[model samples]
Target: MNVRNFSVRRSVVATVAAVTALALAACSGGGSDADADKPSGPVTVKVWAWYPSFQKIVDLYNSTHTDIKIEWTNAGAGQDEYTKLQTALKAGKGAPDVVMLEFQELPTYQLTKHLVDMGKYGANDLKGQYVDWAWKQVSTGDKVYAIPVDAGPMAMLYREDLFKQYGLTIPKTWDEYKAQAEKLKTASAGKAFMTDFGGNDGGFMTGLMWQAGSKPYSYDTANPSNIGISVNDAGAKQVMTYWEGMVNSGLADTKAYGTTDFYNGLGSGKYVTYLAAGWGPGYLASVAKTTAGKWRAAPLPQWTAGGNAQGDWGGSSFAVTDQAKNPEAATKVAMEIYGAKNTDAWKIGIDEAYLFPTATPVLESDAFLKKKYDFFGGQTVNDVFVPAYKAILPFSWSPFNSYNFNQLTTGINGAIEKKTSWTAALDTAQANVTQYATQQGFKVQ
Candidate 1:
């Protein structure tokens, strides 16, 4: 799965103005269950996913289950599938029975009440199969929204060699991180920078806010019209100020995410560290092997020196839509494909796909965790991830997170470009999102 793209934009449907067709389709109740025209026979399970790898997993399922036929389609990755799914859901015309959605994006489906409650279908029995944090991503208020597939818990991936070369120590807190950012630049004779501002990634920026103890957004079931948006809240502002200082100090490069320079910098040692997730190490290793044996993982630097909090960057799950005709079979396909605890399919999803698994058993599998690599000096990658995963702090994902991310990236990135304070950027983001929430029929405070 495209980690950078997935991490950059957490989740969302396309703008409603562009998807006005859904409003018209919803007028007719938009076929919430599978085809009003579907002929009665062996239920054909229609599944839509972005990754081609999923087709193999689906084939594995079809080989065994004769009752339901799994007709899987590689529906293009990321936003393309979501945009179409949203349109289909809105028009009540064309939607798959089983679909893959990022755990963060599950709230987008939930906000529209488009998801089937898998709990009613007895998803509880398989609850033990996944980490609680992963399960929570697929559920809200005791209602099961989907099945956990894969995950990415946030941590720091730094260049161990660079740290030693520059006489810098690993930062254990944000303040120390700032000091080291400046020190590293000076020590490296202006050749290497400490870290990037992670511009273009409001989700990662928001994760930073989460690390600093700020809940910038939330969705309340009772008040759907007006959601809670707090980008410029005191806590968030404080953290933004801290980052603003680093950017001003000329130590943190804000224009890093999605750029060619950023990727190249990883190999050149121009960039020292990054806040990454479970799937990050492999992706980094694949991209920048010149730094092989030089990189190591550590928990994200804390706001308080002794803090152990962590968060997710990218992860997704399988949701059986309310539109499914065969909820049980659909749910089974979802579970069986993701892994029924230590199943070969689960192993494939983790080891083969490099999904950064959320399946508890797969996560703890000796084969999965014990695999050492020359990438991090022959250390088991999981040694960094397991502790990072366990320290994951539960946080909120707003239905409007897609919009939230878009606006924040613009706001913060703009500030970094113009060399202004992040407080102003936070204000800009807050205003844009607040206006958007109001326009979307949500009451915003």
Candidate 2:
């Protein structure tokens, strides 16, 4: 998972704007000239991935394999790499054999038909090896476009000491959560908030909406040029209205996450709970050192009591691009780069990079689930997250996610600033995005 910059996985849709039908006309014959020569030796797969300390994984793969060699390059993170990839895709050359893409960004690339169908290379056989929701993110029906890597399953991190002091129990549902917010406010005399309603992060809010059973955007591989935009759908409005009330009631803080003020809020205990992803523990530990041992992890408050719905915030996958001269070699690299069998890669990802695994073997491993964190007072937070990961409902993303996120950020920020209603914001985003998609030659429904 890319660091959720508070919204660690910041993405941009400027590439979508550049991807006119005219540009795609030139993309039909795209393939890298780098692999024009068929070497007698091992096929060298050019890979573009932004994983930190990724060289360790590459070195391990290269050393242990004789038929394939990985030439790893950190092309840049998120939008930077995406912009470059889009440019290469348009030019019909220069793209790598494999590239790392965030789940939300996959459809945008897939819409251009630049991603290889990994199912042809036996990716479907490994379907049962990964978490279900993660596999769904990278595949649409029978076409597998990428291999799942790490995921950011949603969970709640709260101040255990604060909950105890306020005489509040962990909330089992959204209603209980709201009631607890009221109790926390009364007990603390308005000194602390239940949590901050971060209005500036579209990705974060998307996760919340996902938990509420919102499917704001949908694109079917069957109808590649058609999209479904329902940003103001009933489920989404339900979530928006809930948060709007919280902010209006002064029960939740209205600070943009990852800001200095927001960090201060967590550090000073101005916010009693953090609705965070699997990566939250490490981030919280770094920002709120003094609050160590005061925090504990728990399942996110369900929309319905005892419900199994879950959402994902940040996660990425390795995709084999269509430019690969050797699709089989590239597919092999994509699958095993972070495959379950690669213990060394898993160690680098989990222990060193603090990545939350998406592989079932890693997610269900006793070692991973039992690894205690000193920050959470020796609590095995994965115990909370692993189930959440497994329980996530399959989500679909639009091809214009970057644009969608931008509009959402604008709408949400406007709502928070008293210029609009949350539902109205969604309505505006719906109309604008629909118009934009139609203008881009898509049939927006």
Candidate 3:
């Protein structure tokens, strides 16, 4: 998907304005002694979120509680949400009390001080409830800035019927996967092959690099001054090389079509497999209405023999802003809604079309795993995803992430579109990223 498409939606602007007005009005309530003694009369907390699943929880909360009603506004897409959030933070006045932040953007917002440290309101204990990697996204140094809401455990999704038609086995290693792609190409006589590379969305490349233990930056939380870039690291080079090979070999289609195109192509059996996350199953099921009962889920192929078995693509966190009139009360409600075990809420949310949960306990629940999904031929999709979640490697994310990665992807796109050498394009990307980092006051090691 395009970065702009992922940002918050504009539909929530009215909701935000309404909530802000309510908050201001609540503050202006008559200052009688009894009113002053009252513990902050029912502050209407404003929340901005993207996922329909999260909205379900909010709906549940609103249904159950008369006080502290949450006024929710949907930000268009993930990318749009971040843009709106950054703009609000820069404007510094009308930001929402709670904002949904993508995991990739967590470090950027946290480091830039756009987000409040959730721990300040006794919400620190909430960290213990999620997986280590999920919790690490909003953590910097000794401070916790956000609460993990969901995780995107990586997996390989494929058409079982297509694989059988091509007489191919599910490849376990990257090399084997490539060979299978080639064979499928030959079998289909150039009509079908492996997958599509979403040139517009650079997130797939970043996730692959992270899964291979490559990071864009390293820092010392104790010092809060030291920083190092890993764009030129060996792992990153390997990732780029692999991507280049895929494009050059014609095993993967390098198209600008966003997720919609990718899903449509997959559903029509235009490709054999896709490297995706836990939420992908539901997304594909919805989009590939005609391909039901033909697809299946499998473990991701390894880059090398016996390599790390896990990877992650995307996830999100919830943060309470410092500007909230009743930070304590808002957090109390947030924790109760997000931190507590709400299986029914989660199932309802997922059923209503939000992605899977990042909460480990929820993943382990029978209700989550045993659901009969008609997509993927009734296969237990959760079974494949849960294992992948355990394999993700935790790394410290930096504030310079979005800028650096965008530049790198832009350079890559230029190279492919202009027929430039990979090495030269990557070298240019490295220099550009380093310069951008320096301008942001980060050390480029």
Best by lDDT: 2
Q: Quote model 3's TM-score.
A: 0.87
Q: Model 1 over residues 1-445: C-alpha lDDT tens digits?
A: 3444544354443564344323322323433444346556677888987643566777777787777788988666777687778878766668888998876567667666677778877887787776666677777666788887766777888999889999988888888888898899889878888877787776677767766667887765434444678878887887789888887877877655667777888888888997787777877887787788999887788878788877666777888887787777788777777665536676566555667877777777787779786788987878778777766766777766677777777777788878777798888888887877666656676
lDDT of 1: 0.73
Name the TM-score of candidate 2: 0.93
Local accuracy of candidate 2 as per-residue lDDT tens digits, 1-445: 7554645445455666776453333335354343366677899999998776788889999999999999988888777788888888777789999999989888877777788888988999889998678898899888999998888888889999989888999998999999999999899999999999878777789888998899988777657776788888888999999998898898999888889899999999899899988877887888889998989998999887789888888888999887898888899999998998777888888776678888898777877889899999999999999989888888989877888888988888888887469999999998998888888878777
Q: What's the true lDDT of residue 243 in model 2?
A: 92
lDDT of each residue in 1-445, candidate 3, tens digit only: 1122422211233333332233323332332121133255666888887676666688888887777789998865665666666567555566787877777666555444445556767766766677777777777545777777777777899999999998989988889998998998889988885988765555666677777777667754334334676676777777778777877888887665345666667777888887777778877776678988998898888887877557677777777765566666666666666554876677775676546777767777887778667887888888888878877878666555555556666777786788666556667777876665565455556
**What Cα-based lDDT does every candidate model obtain?**
0.73, 0.84, 0.68
Per-model TM-score on C-alpha atoms? 0.90, 0.93, 0.87
lDDT of 3: 0.68
- TM-score, cand. 1 vs. native: 0.90
